[model samples]
Target: MKINVMTDILEANDRIAAVNRQLFDSHKNLVLNLMSSPGAGKTMLLEKTAQALRGKLRLGVIVGDVETARDKERLEKYDLPVVQLNTGSACHLDANMIASALPHVDLTNIDVLVIENVGNLVCPAEFRVGEDFKIMILSVTEGDEKPLKYPLMFRESSLLLINKIDLLKYTNFNLDEAKANARKVNPNIEIVDISCVTGEGISDWAAWLSGCYKRKFGTNSLA
Candidate 1:
């Protein structure tokens, strides 16, 4: 009975997600769902990506967290359309939450929408929130075993950003092992090493994002 209920919930969520995807497609907006554990620098990466891609593409963000609007506050400096969804106690964001937040942002004017899912490696990957790509970030501080232990996020993501390389020397994390495990799960996942603090590899990440945008909307990104 429990399994059937869970399956039904996911099916319903997928139906809403398909609707959301169609809405985004109609507006020519490329939506990226960003997920990571707590303290993995998801917000910081967005700040840097926003700066890197500013003017090149019109951006909007949907910040999802269990509580508090702190992440939304940090992103408000950009003055772009921002929506904060506080799930209260939910560990992850779902398609319904995203569908609720879409009305708050002007989807017609935004070229790309970044949905920052609540900090969790498990449930977030199970739910699709109408995104073009799921970009997962794993800080070197989180250790190399994460990809093997939390294989779903690694496998489900289209791109993986190994963040916080500045602390790589201090920590015992192995870049090779991390890449090997991630590649084992997702053979085609595009992985990039990034440090949001020092601004390392931000351009590559931003370029990949913009490339998706240009490919989706063509040369004229006025949409």
Candidate 2:
């Protein structure tokens, strides 16, 4: 009975996600769902990405959190279209939550829409909020064994950003082992090491994001 109920819930969410995907396709907008554990620099990455792609792309963000509007406030500094979805007690943001927020976002003028899911490595991976791709972040401080313990996020994500590399000297995290473990779970996952504080590898991330946006829109304006 429990399994059936869970399946039904996911089916319902997928239905809404399909509707959201159609809306995004109509406007030729690429939506990215970003997920990570708490304090994994999700907002910091979003801030940097928004600033880097400021004039080149019509970028927008939907910030999801269990409480607080702090992430939304940080993103607003970019001066682009931003919406904060407070999920109250929900651990993760589902397609229904995204559908509710779509009414507030002007999809026509937006080229890329990034939904920053709640700061969680687990539950968020189970829900699809109608995104073209899923991007997951894992900080070095979280340890290299995370991929094996929490494989679903790694398996679901198309891109993985291993953040906080600058702090490697202070910790015992092994980059190769982390990559290997993630690859074991998701052989096709593209992983990049980045540090939001030191500005390391931010350019590659920004370029890749721009490329994705262009691929969906099919234009050379970003280049």
Candidate 3:
């Protein structure tokens, strides 16, 4: 006989995640789990999002990393309530981590909560943190084969942000192929091309976020 440790861990996490989902729903919060590989521009995109939706939406953030508050520090200047979770050796942020951090953030004060999961294409996709959507970023410099290489990440995500598109000329990343591959894995996944550095597509991303918030809150206006 053998113990299925991984199965047990996931089952435990799912139970916590369900509880978290109820709390978020009660607060009318639109939660998003943002995942990406290291250097894929997750922080930059969040920074841009903060700037874009400043007056329109009240945002909250949970920054997760192996051992740093650097990302948390970066978003604090935006005046958003940010909680930093240093996961130590954990490669992914499990539901228990989010449930523990919830007390640090006032869910009622935020229109949306974005959890920046530890920068990994693999483990992050395997865990559910009670998010309304799982959004992943793949930078052009990382190449187009990422969707195929990390099929589960694509399959699990609701949206695929093709980041660093301004640097496309410098890299051989094929946008068409990347979208095709992502669609192959997740047919309904929304794809958006963006550049945090150039400010391209930030409005579109913000609009999408606002739409989700409005839908969750049952409001007709973002204001």
Q: What is the C-alpha local distance difference test score of each model?
A: 0.91, 0.91, 0.91
Q: Rank by lDDT, descending?
A: 3, 1, 2
| Model 2 C-alpha lDDT per residue in residues 27-53, reported as the tens digit of each score | 878899999999999999988887777
Which regions of candidate 1 are displaced past 4 Å? Answer: 1-9
Best-to-worst order by TM-score is: 3, 1, 2
Q: After superposition, how far is residue 198 of candidate 3 from its true place, in Å?
A: 0.9
Counted clashes in each candidate structure = 0, 0, 0
**Model 2 alpha-carbon miss at residue 18, Å:** 0.3
Candidate 1: clashing pairs of residues: none
Instruction: Name model 2 segments beyond 4 Å from true.
Output: 1-9, 221-223
**Pairs in clash, predicted candidate 3:** none
> Per-residue lDDT for 1-223 in model 3, tens only?
9876555758888899999999999988889999999999988898899899887887889999999799999999888899999999999999999999999899888878999999999999988999999999999999999999999999999889999999999998899999999999899999989999999999999989988887778783334
The true-versus-predicted C-alpha distance at residue 116 of model 1, in Å, is 0.2
Least accurate stretch of 10 residues (summed lDDT) in model 1?
A: 1-10
Instruction: Name the better of 2 and 3 by lDDT.
Output: 3
